[model samples]
Target: MAERPRVWVSQPLFADIVGRLGEHFEVSATETVVQHAPDAVAAALREADGALVTLNDAIGAAQVAGAGRLRAIANVGVGYNNLDLPALSAAGILATNTPDVLTETTADFGFALMMATARRITEAERWLREGHWRQWSFESLLGGDIHGATLGILGMGRIGRGIARRASGFGMRVLYHNRSRLPEAVEREHAAQYVGFEALFERADHLVLVLPYAPEHHHLVDAVALARLRPHATLTNIARGGLIDEDALADALGAGRLAAAGLDVFEGEPAINPRLLALRNVVLTPHIASGSLATRRAMVALAVDNLIAALGYGPDAGRPPSPLNADALTHARKRGA
Candidate 1:
């Protein structure tokens, strides 16, 4: 019998769903969640034919330097910033990500967070729980209004479009800024107008960040950008945390330069800036934008499908559904790897 290919799962995932990989490969799954150091990640991938990783694991050139056996990496999230594409391509390894499956779910959470920030939901709850809501004072717990407001979205991707569609029911005037403008039909369908980057900050009553992270986008929301926002505007980030300068945000919120903020992802996540925690106006959540049970399961299933196919064992063998670097597969084949 031919030897079965080996695979590594970086963190504990849905047991039954990930167990499916066992049928075709020798699976090495971590029992507990771990913050893998670069060297540790390299050690694990050194012997595996493929890996199933989440955002928690960072894979780069040094990690895959001599990982000749690593052929594919199935990322369980839409964003692949955790994986260094150039490095993986040089290593002749295919990469796949789970997209579309979490689009609506993430958008739902993004809008919810925005509303919560605008209405001071969590802040109110905390105050009420602390016995501060003695009576309905006219000016008590005042917050920005959502209905008939200008909703500005950065990054007009699928999730951004979903948020815009939801905004229509609230009678919001939607504006968006992206790398390029969406087609006229799409703009009409969502009733979203394209605007320049600075104009988005100036015109928005509420601004939501859904842009993917890139090196150039690091700290895109610094003090200068925050100053562009109206003092009454709310800022919500359902995107990557590295996109915001948390200290600058904290300063803005502390000084009341901005109304409020809702953040789902933070820089150095699982360990947030203490400054944000001190601010009462900022609402923070552990990254759970795609936390809906059904959607999360779908993401895992898609990743499983990608892994099985990329490893050349499933019905769609050699044709992963969402390959990030398909050319790597061809390169591997040419070298008879």
Candidate 2:
């Protein structure tokens, strides 16, 4: 009999999606839903051949160093900051993320959040719910407009392109800044202008953050960057939290240095900076940008597929939709390293 591969699921994801993994591997999962501490996660990884994790689980290099049998880690979200890439590479392990399936869905959420922030949707709803809507006034809920405004996107990847495509219908001028310039044809098709980061912060009436999180990208939108924006601008972040500084953002909002903000991710998961929460100008969500019923299910399905493939079962097992550390395979084979 073939010995079933030992797999650990770090979180309680979609039940059906998790159950499917059981068919191909010996799966161990937590019964109750909770964020596992790094020590707990490390302990679990020590006994498993591979893991299915969420962004909340921080799998650092030290943790992976102890996992002698660890081969692959299938992340439930598009972001992979939770997993230490250098550590994973050093350990010769594969890391996969569910990317393409969530692109359009996440972009839709980014647009919606931006609009909600710009138009004061959440604040207005709260005003009504608190029975403060006794009478109507001309400037009662005055907010910024989306049409004819400039939309600034920090990242020029798949999701950023999706956001750019949506700008046309709103009659927005899209400006983007990426590490490398996208093709001239793509820019012409989307009517997006590739600009410098400084120009993006200055001219954009609406700024959206979609850049990947890295140590170098930590606090990319610091207080200085926030100060550079127009006072009437709206800031939206659907990307990883570390891309912006929450305290700096709150300070800007408090001082009226910035108009409003929509945040789907934060520097820390489950715990948001209290300063941002105290302000009415900021709209906050619990990192569910790719959380549409259909999209989230698809994300889980792809993750399940990755786990199955990496476990040497499915036809495409070991071939993930997106592998963060694809170079690890080559390094592992070199000198049998």
Candidate 3:
């Protein structure tokens, strides 16, 4: 008998969906959602043939350095920043992510977060719960209107376009800034106008960020950019936490420079900034943008499919869907040949 290839599941995901991997390979999955230490991740990959990971697992260069058998890493979320692409590519490891499946779900959450921030929904709930309902006067808890407002989108990706289409119902003029201009037909389809990066900050009454985070975009929305926003404008971030400077955002909220802000992701997640916590104007949520039951399940299913295909199993064997590093396989074949 031949030894079966082994795979590791970095976190505890849906059992039924993860069990699919066990059909084709030996599976070692964590029992709990844990923040794995770098060395621990390295050790697991050192033995496993592939891994199913979430954002919680940070697989960097050091981790892949000793991963002699690691052929693939299927990330459950759309973002692959948690996995070091350069390191994985150099090590001939295929990296795949679950995208498209969560786009609409994430857009829904982004809009909901924005509306909550603009209307002070979360703040009002806290106030009412705290016995402040007695003070609910006609003029109390004034919030900005969503209808007929300028909705600015920082990234014009699939999620951002979904948001733009949703905005059409509210009759908002959509302005967007992306790395490149979307096609004219696409711009027309969503009724979104392409604007310069600074114009997006200046003109939008409510700005929603759906941009993917990268090293160059760290703290992209600092005090300087926040200052450009109309004093009454609201900002929503369903993207990466590192996009905005928490200190700058807290200062803006505290000093009344901005109307309000909604944040789903944070720079230091699970451990929030105390300064932002103190402010009432900000709407804060633990990262759950793509957290609907159906969407999460679909994401897991897609990741499982990606992993199976990546490991040379399933119908799509040797061609994993949504591969970030398919070239790694070519590198492997060249070396093997």
Candidate 4:
């Protein structure tokens, strides 16, 4: 019998869901959590026909320079900024990500985080836990109101629209700034107003960052942008950490320039800024916006399906549902033809 094609799973995932890959191919999955360096990823891919990776593993030109046998990569997250798409395309490797499944789950968390930040829920809990709530002072732990406030969303994608729908229930006005204005129909569906980048910062009562990270977007919310916000306005970031300058944010929070912040993703993940940790006003969660049990399992299942189909081993062979570079697959087929 022919040998089964080899696959490498770069991190530990739900064994049962990932075990599905074992039925179709030889699976080499990581037993422990590992922060894979670029060179380490290259070494693993050198022997793999395909790889299942999470955002923790960064795969770029240097990582895939000698991965001659690597044909497909299934990322278990919606964002693929960790992967170098141009290099993968040049190498004729197919890359896929799990998208739609995590949308509502992530949007749910974004709204929750925003509410937590605006209401100072975590801060008040900590104060109570420390036995500081001896007397119920009327002025203690005051927070911004969510209802009847203007919500400014930096990115108006599917997740952003979901958040807008939620805000409607609270009677909050939804304002969004995106690369392009959403269609009038979509605007009506979400009851969202289109605004410019500067206008969003000036007008929002609570600002939520749902934008994707890119090289150009580094420090998109720096001191200058924070300066535009109302002194009592809150900031919630369910997006990438690189979008905000940590030092600037810490200074803003410390000096009371901004009311508070809720951050899920950080710039140097797993190793957050020490300054952010020192501030009580900032609510920090370890990059778990889509952390619900059901949602995570769905993500893993979708990634596994992408891998099986991308490798021509499943009923949907050659038609992975979320191909990042379908053009590369087409070119390869034409070359073979």
The candidate that achieves the highest TM-score relative to the unseen native structure? 3
Model 2's alpha-carbon lDDT is: 0.89
The parts of candidate 2 lying over 4 Å away from their true place are 334-337
Going through the candidates in order, what is the number of backbone clashes in each? Answer: 0, 3, 0, 0
In terms of TM-score, how similar is model 3 to the real structure?
0.99
Full-model lDDT for every candidate: 0.95, 0.89, 0.94, 0.93
Error of 3 at 20 (Å): 1.0
Candidate 3, residue 20: lDDT = 92
- Predict model 4's lDDT versus the native: 0.93
What is the full ranking by lDDT, best candidate first?
Answer: 1, 3, 4, 2
Write down the lDDT that model 1 would get: 0.95
Cα deviation of 237 in candidate 1 (Å)? 0.4
lDDT of 1 by residue, 76-179 (tens): 99998999998898778999999999999999999999999999999999999999878769999999989999999999999999999999999999999999
TM-score of predicted structure 1: 0.98
Distance from true location, Cα of 181 in model 2, Å:
1.0
Q: Which candidate model has the greater TM-score, 2 or 3?
A: 3
* Model 2 lDDT per residue over 152-222, tens place: 99998999999989999999999999999999999999899999999999999999999998899999999
Instruction: List the candidate 4 regions with Cα displacement exceeding 4 Å.
Output: 330-337
- The predictions' CA RMSDs to the true structure, in order, are 1.2, 1.5, 0.9, 1.3
